[model samples]
Target: MRFTDLISYQALLEPSKPAIVAGGKIVTFGMLEHAVRSLSGRIHALGLQPGSLVGLSIEVPSRHVALSLALARCGLVSVPYASAATLSQLPPLALGLSDGGLVVGSAAINLVVTDEWFAPSEQPVPDVAIADDADCRVFMSSGTTGTPKPIFQSFGGMDAQAQVVANHHLLAGRVSRILCAMPLKSAWGYRSTIAALANGIAVYFAAGTADIPMTLAAYGCEYLICSVYQLQELVRLQSETMIPLPSLAAVCTGGSLVPAELVRSAQSLLCSRIILIYGSSEVGHSALEVAGMHPWQDGATGFVTPWTEMEAIAEDGRVLPRGETGELRVRSFAQARFGGQPAPDGELPWFYPGDRGSISPDGRLTISGRTVDILNIGGTKLSSERIEHALKRHPMVIDAGVMGVADRQGLTEVRAAVTVRGAVAEAELRSFVATSFPVAAPQMIKIVAAIPRGDTGKILREELRALLN
Candidate 1:
């Protein structure tokens, strides 16, 4: 049931198979296994034992992955920060190590190690066996609305997700290599990488959208995964260069609302089809839509995946019938525990992703908006999603977000930020929204270069609000 066991099995079966491709280098399974063991020994020398929480801030995708496996090999818990900046915001780690050799500690211990810290060591590190229920990884929330919460995943949960992904059949045997267009620290990126490795598929970590063409041309990749933002960038790049990735079979995207136009563009230019996934870090792979096979629905995210059970529950805890819009609750075998509290046996708790959506009789899910995204304007509770939708209806507006700002008089003011494909006047956008809801028209509309989003494509409302302020 160990995560490393999967790699070990792959190494034994196909030692020379390429596992990771990054920065013009290919790392085989044999090399990956050796690096994991070497890094595990280094971690052990740092006085970190099994179950100890280690802060990982590696920038290199290969090293980040290697360190993650090393931590799992030693049965230590890993808390990966998206960047070093994020690492500094949290409670300072007791000790830290990087390629730069900067070592800092709280009270006494501080030692600097050079690039030798990354050198492989044959020294055997004690294998601290991990229990199935023990927490092995903690994922930080995207912090779109507030402070990021720690979402904990047990060893069993991780293994279950890998198996679920392996059996999902979307990339089963069709995908030999995948290009990751998102940061490895993100839940989506990490899950995709692990699933690919678990299936013995090679992963290419593209530096950015600029590197996508080169990577695809040099090394053929069948699958691509990224957030909506990265997908947009890729499409933009392709449109400008007029280069098509004929080797790419499918592109899977998540993290924000996928516009029908973007999906169509991606299908025509980037790949043959687009797979839009709908889920949160708490509930993995709740639903997905294969765009090539299905017609696009205005607000539909997709059909529920095989391994997920979803329901729309009213505020009173009543489960609504299908086709009724309410708060979405998802129950998946691969669901993670928040705040480190496991649900009681025989009563697996349903995960509330804060999305207000409905399930059709045929199992299609359409999300109207998020419960937290509702705005209290004057005396009425207005759906910001509705306003954003109105703005996006304009031919020039590509994306929009609305937020309520409170003044000293306890009055709420509606403000909007929008990204446009062409020049769009704020008055025109405001007038367009006024045509929909004249009374709840936005007080102010500002055109921006881009919408603030996390790696997964979720809007960073906190940052958006900051910009509005």
Candidate 2:
């Protein structure tokens, strides 16, 4: 499959199915297909070769979905860039991709002299050809290490990943709608779009955070995919509004190491099972929760396919015995970026996804913390996840994030920020946390409506750091 066939196949079978609802606009599968066919014709007229790489920088809309599916139908490789990129970044991206493309919605830089703009399009970028082995899209890292590395994923691998997300999160489901912020351009958005389209469901997008529920009600959405943090926020809102939301089925929050508290709260609020989906643009299956009525059963090591195996290995480079904590690693179903290195055949490609976890005696896996999320608090080594897990046992604390901020003398104190159950006293919550874990008791606990989460439900550590300062 060339990846574009996701919605195309469904359009033939269930053309009347709703495909997208943005604002008040609703696009049926039949209508979206027509738009794609027409836009593809316009795309070909633009002289961009079929299978060529093109970029899109636009807000989420029916047209965004139409153009992407059209490109897939037309066999063009697409990379949807974040709006955060600077004018200085475009020309280099253009030169490196070597695909003559233009900014879809920008006027200032497009009008100014630039080698990147072959011929500008105020409309979406057109379709071009992409090879089976060719790079389909490039994912830039968060620039945590100064500048982010642009990671390229293959079209074939991404197709398999779509299957993973669908099966793992129940997108191979019967639902009326799917929702996201279009936060990540890769599987989070692309595969999500494909999964829903493949299953003949509608996808809805809220213009901003304030309108999430309004967007759902407006679109008649029933299924949602968000970062863990987004789910917590939703729960906080639901607790307040006391309004019945669009009937939800399943929720999958990716793009970071999602917290169980986020899952627990959303499960209660949405009245649906919350499955933690672990994946990245490089490879989709690090692991995932099993589907079915018992999806969140404590020990399921994500729905595994015949293509890969999951491992928990210690710092000593040995796969840990069951019931021990170590770094989580994976072998891919397809060739992918393994620990920042290229895969070689028959080698069983592996990469540490920065999660710290333990394998159970029953052969199930449990994630404990991030491999990099370790610190020495007064010479006692502690993983932030341990304190968090213990702290969340309290009913009042809905979600919690712990960080060991070390000062000048190398003394590190653990700081905990909590998304509480509606409104709870701050001092009492701190005392509750202090009484939970003796190893790294929280010196402080701040309650908010919800914790700050990035695209994926992982607590934004930097944002929490700012809260204390």
Candidate 3:
């Protein structure tokens, strides 16, 4: 079923139930359905085909959410761009992803949806049939390299993945209110929002990271979905004043490497269950760990979900035994595809998630690092995540990023950049690293106000290297 249908079902069951809260405005399920249907009727008047691709560039979360549901109801593939992207970046991104159609706020590129389109008329919400194989949504990859690649999710895949997320998180009926602090364009935000709405849960969109605690307190939200960096900032803020969010039961964090220290601190300050999720756009949640229920290790990402299959493979493409570190490959029941490629030949096809990790004999997964972020220094391979984890152990360091840069002699040398809470001597940090990891210690350490990161909180290795140069 389409995502809009989920909203419609909720509206049918509880029309007066709060559906979305954004920009200090609350929209009930009934109001949401009416707006979606009205907007969808306008879209259908544009003569766009069922399977046509459309780009969404709306800035307001409420409007963005409404238009997204309208597109789904119209059976059109929606490619939502990050509202914060520059004007110059939007054209290329829309052109590359959308099929000659773009919707920016209330305006349309190839078609117009004016006041007349939404005027009183009996247009019966245009009966459009969507095939299961048709592309339902296209999510842009968070890679820092060339043009962002589009990851397509079929309608069936979207529903299945949403179900898996809802079931795994115990979101259905159990969660009444949730707060989303991530960008709407992100896969995590899109999928999580759908799961919440499908489960008839009310969602509140925080204005920014600073507003999250207030939003949660104001809405009395029971759950929060945020990135690791946001969680860290919240923990830091909690240390100052305990933001009253007594209803908050769980805080789900992912989209980057989550420090064990951050999890422990958040649990103490927030007084909520902290869940660490490990997954990517290509594959829905593969593993997760709950703070109090699961044993929190330095790099452990929890155990693989029952609906997913995971394996670690060596460079030679041979599957490694448990306890051996290698690249992780996962296959889920959701059957996610990279772009348009089908799963490889097997009873269940495996999709390599580009992360290096290992599974223990008891089925716990430990994420070692990213395959692309591995650093080669003096012929010794080192995981950047390992080095960053070590740096964060320092009392003064709040954040750290490590990368490999070339030296004057043309040899690769490990370089580290950090964001510290207070003044920290370079020699002191170097001595701390040298004592713990002498062989893989960074050759140079630079203290900056903040480390560079992409939208998903992954460290931009190239950007970090540029800072060193």
Q: What does each candidate score in C-alpha RMSD?
A: 3.4, 5.7, 3.9
Q: Over the full model, what C-alpha lDDT does candidate 1 score relative to the true structure?
A: 0.76
Instruction: List, residue by residue over 182-286, the lDDT tens digit for candidate 2.
Output: 464544666677666766767787766557777766655667777645665677777677566756666666544445555666666765666656665556656
Please report how far candidate 1 places residue 349 from its true position, in Å.
Answer: 2.1
- Model 2 scores worst on lDDT over the 10 consecutive residues at 107-116
Count of backbone clashes for each model?
2, 13, 0
lDDT of every model, 2 decimals: 0.76, 0.61, 0.76
If scored against the real structure, what TM-score would every candidate get?
0.87, 0.77, 0.89
lDDT agreement of model 3 with the native:
0.76
lDDT minimum window of 10 residues, candidate 1:
101-110
